[model samples]
Target: MLIFSKAKLVFLSMPKTGTTAYETALSPFASQYVCDPPELKHAPVYRYNRFFRPMLEKFVSPDIETLAVVREPIDWLGSWYRYRHRPFLAGKPTSTAGMSFDAFVQAYCKGSRPAFANVGSQVNFVKPQPNGTKVDHLFRYENQSGLLTFLEERLGIKIELARENVSPAMPLSLSPEVEEKLRRKCAEEFELWESIT
Candidate 1:
């Protein structure tokens, strides 16, 4: 949620938005502190990143350019479920582990348990940008071409990311009702999908 200008760049990683891929692609133009996004800790990445931003700014010449990719809530949530339910966490609960996506969403909205352990909550991307609008450039996941152009033009880095993230149909097992509910409830999140993916 930050846009950097005349400063170093840093990608404030959002979960599963091809953040890992972007980290690798943008590494050459950034500082050596480039690390991947952390795990489920209830706080947004911007908060933690911003807390360290001052130290980074005082110690370094220019602050890191902040960047992150966002995905649609429905697509993001579905993909998140599939991503967590992969072979590694097959035995573990998925985004819809204990209940259907709708049920989990109901609980989440009502202050019950969370659906997924990752970026499943609305708070993940709901917070304000930590560095205001001076964090440099941010790229959209759906706007792949534009993103590439921005990186090349701004960071002078050219790279390729996998073409596997975007799709029309979400992963199976989720009912249409559940999908619709999640989408409506997370309209803001869906709005950021094109920006985050």
Candidate 2:
């Protein structure tokens, strides 16, 4: 279940799904925000499932609207690759920057992943707000326009996003071998994301 309220909307940040971009664009709307400064950035009443929903509902303004953004598994996985393994960050000779789509697919197939480091664990999933209110808005990262339309229509605000954590610095498609591996590795999540797409 996904949930959000206008008084406090929680961004369940799945790594590399453009959380930074969304946060930047949407900050003006939030009453409080974490990951931003105190002057302009309002802290979350709470960010995660930290407190009971009814308890939060009581405190937050009645008009809060909550939202989240998601992306396709294939592209999302590709971005995860660039974000994690890029050599530029360490300023080394830029070689072996990204894993083969095949190898990355194989690694993702393993069920368990470390909390923040692994691909599937950080992404490929969504977490619900406490007490499980259905999400008011779900945006598709693959279709930024669609997401923007959704938010504008519902929230009555126009948003322009400058995306950080951008991936596919050089846009590359997955090979057939890699595609099949991905299809096989993330069957369940692929199906779900496909439906969303």
Candidate 3:
């Protein structure tokens, strides 16, 4: 997460949405940047509301707004699938070494997901908190220009992005049956993505 105190903006790092590149590009301008201990780095709305919100409100500003980027659902899952396919995770329970994209996504749609398909939901990551805290600005990952324009105008600085922490490229094909199951089981994921104009 990157916090620009002066701008009263906090960029929430939604996993697999290419926030790492934003973090890298904006770190120098941010008042605070949390990039370690994956849990904190990728703290969702609830986590931020619990941990960072109170502190920032007290010490920085009470009007801090949050920004988050969400990717197309299937593409997001594919990133996770390919990421775990990396050689480093070859033998781990979380590895997707021999799994087809269909199997991986089917696992993800399960009530109790297997380790390899346990990537957290993007919908949950940006869900509104009980106290009204929420993502004030949301962007689609595919719309880089829109996000960059918002950031540049808000921060009053020119911006550039470099790809970072990208998953390895692979040909992923999800069978129609599995895809249908995923959409049925995880409708919120699709709904949330579509809602991000």
RMSD of each: 5.0, 5.5, 0.6
- Residue ranges of candidate 3 with Cα displaced over 4 Å: none
Question: What are the per-residue Cα lDDT tens digits for candidate 1 across 73-95?
Answer: 55556565556444445455443
- Which structure among the candidates has the greatest lDDT? 3
Against the reference, the lDDT scores of all candidates come to: 0.52, 0.56, 0.95
Cα RMSD of predicted structure 2: 5.5
In candidate 2, how many Å is residue 181 off?
Answer: 3.1
What would the per-residue lDDT of candidate 2 be over residues 1-197, giving only the tens digit for each residue?
12335525555455566767877777677554456343122222233334434555678654445555667777777676666556564433322254465565556666764322254432224444456654455667677788777666655688888867576475556778768876776676666566564
Model 1 misplaced regions, further than 4 Å: 1-7, 36-45, 61-64, 93-110, 115-118, 129-138, 162-170, 191-197
What's model 2's overall lDDT?
A: 0.56
Off by over 4 Å in 2: 1-9, 36-47, 52-55, 61-65, 88-98, 112-117, 121-124, 127-134, 171-173
- Candidate 3, number of clashes: 0
Model 2: lDDT of residue 91: 38
| Residue 126 error, candidate 2, Å | 2.1
| Most accurate candidate by TM-score | 3
Candidate 1: deviation at residue 148, Å?
1.1
Compare candidates 2 and 3 on lDDT and give the better one. Answer: 3
